[model samples]
Target: MLNTWYYSDAPRTVRPMLSVMRRQSGFAEIIGDIDQENATFEARRCLSCGNCFECDNCYGVCPDNAIRKLGPGNRFEFKYDYCKGCGLCPSECPCGAIMMIPEEI
Candidate 1:
């Protein structure tokens, strides 16, 4: 049940372009629908494991004080203000917890 409003505009339909426009629109609709369905399924599969949403696995292990303890309700806040991105937190997580995203260069 994807909403079609998210799709980009159909291309211009000139003499030689009409077929291409149709094909592009069809492909866009199919891809968008499949992606929407996959997203819905993945959202349903999350188990919400009892571990803390902000489980301080990284906070406890960081040697450099890079990760900060923001008073938590959910989701641990990282103080990239000083994080060296040593990749320690992601490595130490027993549940495949944190992921190390690249810092902006």
Candidate 2:
């Protein structure tokens, strides 16, 4: 099994933030909202809010480019043809929409 970390009574998972300039831009693109290291640390801290606001974190962090942007408010789709189950989507997903399930070899 891949190693995982757990936190208790620790700091909360910092929500993906938009820069002040971006915020003022009204609809800013938050592609690289969360970093890999930051995402890993926030695993246990995740709020599991269960809402995909379509921040595009998965789109940017996907190394395989498996995620497809269906346009504004359309959400996204996974192209299994490209997905290698690298676990980046789930880790980068701000909302708990995407999750990783172990595939038996």
Candidate 3:
């Protein structure tokens, strides 16, 4: 056995987004279209933010049928109309993407 370590020296890449000045128009869709390379690179950034990766875990685990399946790669939506805040989604989420926020009445 020998002691050796190595890592890629290439700089990290980022997806291009609209500048704050131009985004203030509220036209929606701040992120610009990216090439296949950047798209793949951007997709890898999901885990860094605890973003939903469309794993369908919460969708299957919801007992109230509150989790709405928004199609492939679109992630999911909490159907508050049916959801009772059972805290199941957040607990079942593998990536810690689901969160529970108490509503004040």
Candidate 4:
């Protein structure tokens, strides 16, 4: 297992280590390195809160038809070519899943 130590804004240095069962670390392993056991323990602490996994609720309900569906049927994509930056989709998301970021200048 790989162990990483980094500084946080709160205070002293932090050390994050990968779980014992895993052999190597990936991107998630890096981010979740802090107190592997504790982090994994906390990860399961979520309430789920009736959330949807990128359900594409916004993509399906766009009024301007700006959203584009890419990838396979299981995985869809959203294109903002004709998007007016309307807050409808973001507002309509039940799980607060979609967030509207300002387009790059």
Candidate 5:
């Protein structure tokens, strides 16, 4: 045991890269459609460098539903009794917020 939760068998879903370019409204139009919502989502796609941004990736992917939401800005917590140590939460964690520590005897 490396004292960590490593899910080597977890399946990873690869999403296609979206190219968001400034597209003109018309063939000859110079103005573009400012999609602020889409832009914001795309902006969040940037690498978080292993920080919790409360994106809910871990919370959403937990099969056991062991991860509990602590409301907005509070992040989440693991219900160890229900967690079963499946490593699903750690694997699905996009920002590496969940670290798997080995259970000591």
Candidate 6:
């Protein structure tokens, strides 16, 4: 199951009215939090391609058990021995981090 509050499978909705709001407010640099814990929290929002944040969507959704969980902070590994190349992991990825490539012959 996905956390709907944090994860969204569908494309983000566009807010056309936000442009009018922006025009009224003008553009400004919104500084991010400088605290370490706050920074780490924000870092979790990163896509983390070729890396991992242990979101577990892949590990939870794989039908073939090809994605292995290596515990917290260790990330995941693809178990080619059991993988079927279903393309589901990359498809379900919310952050657009994973990409598919053709195998070299």
How high is the CA lDDT of each candidate model? 0.58, 0.73, 0.70, 0.56, 0.66, 0.65
lDDT, candidate 1, at 77: 69
Candidate of highest lDDT = 2
Stretches off by above 4 angstroms in model 3 are 1-49
Per-candidate TM-scores read: 0.43, 0.51, 0.53, 0.40, 0.55, 0.53
Worst 10 residues of 3 by lDDT: 1-10
Those runs of model 4 whose alpha carbons end farther than 4 Å from true positions after fitting are 1-51, 54-56, 70-75
Q: What's the true lDDT of residue 62 in model 3?
A: 88
Best-to-worst ranking by lDDT: 2, 3, 5, 6, 1, 4
Superposed Cα deviation of residue 19, candidate 5 (Å): 30
Candidate 2 per-residue lDDT over residues 1-105, each given as its tens digit: 211231145674566777888888788665446677777877756554766767788899999889999999899999988899888888767667777777677
How far in Å is the alpha carbon of 47 misplaced in model 6? 5.9
- The predictions' CA RMSDs to the true structure, in order, are 14.4, 15.7, 13.9, 13.6, 10.5, 8.1
> Residue 71 in candidate 5 has what lDDT?
95
Candidate no. 6 TM-score: 0.53
Task: For candidate 5, write residues 1-105 as lDDT tens digits.
Answer: 121233233333333333334233334334444366656655645555566778787788888989899999888888889988888777777657678999999
Error of 3 at 21 (Å): 53
* Clash count (model 1, backbone only): 0
Model 2 RMSD to the real structure?
15.7
Strongest candidate by TM-score: 5
Tens digits of per-residue lDDT, candidate 3, 1-105, equal: 111121123445765788898899879788777788977765554442366767677888889999888888777777899998888777766667776779999
Better of 3 and 4 by TM-score: 3
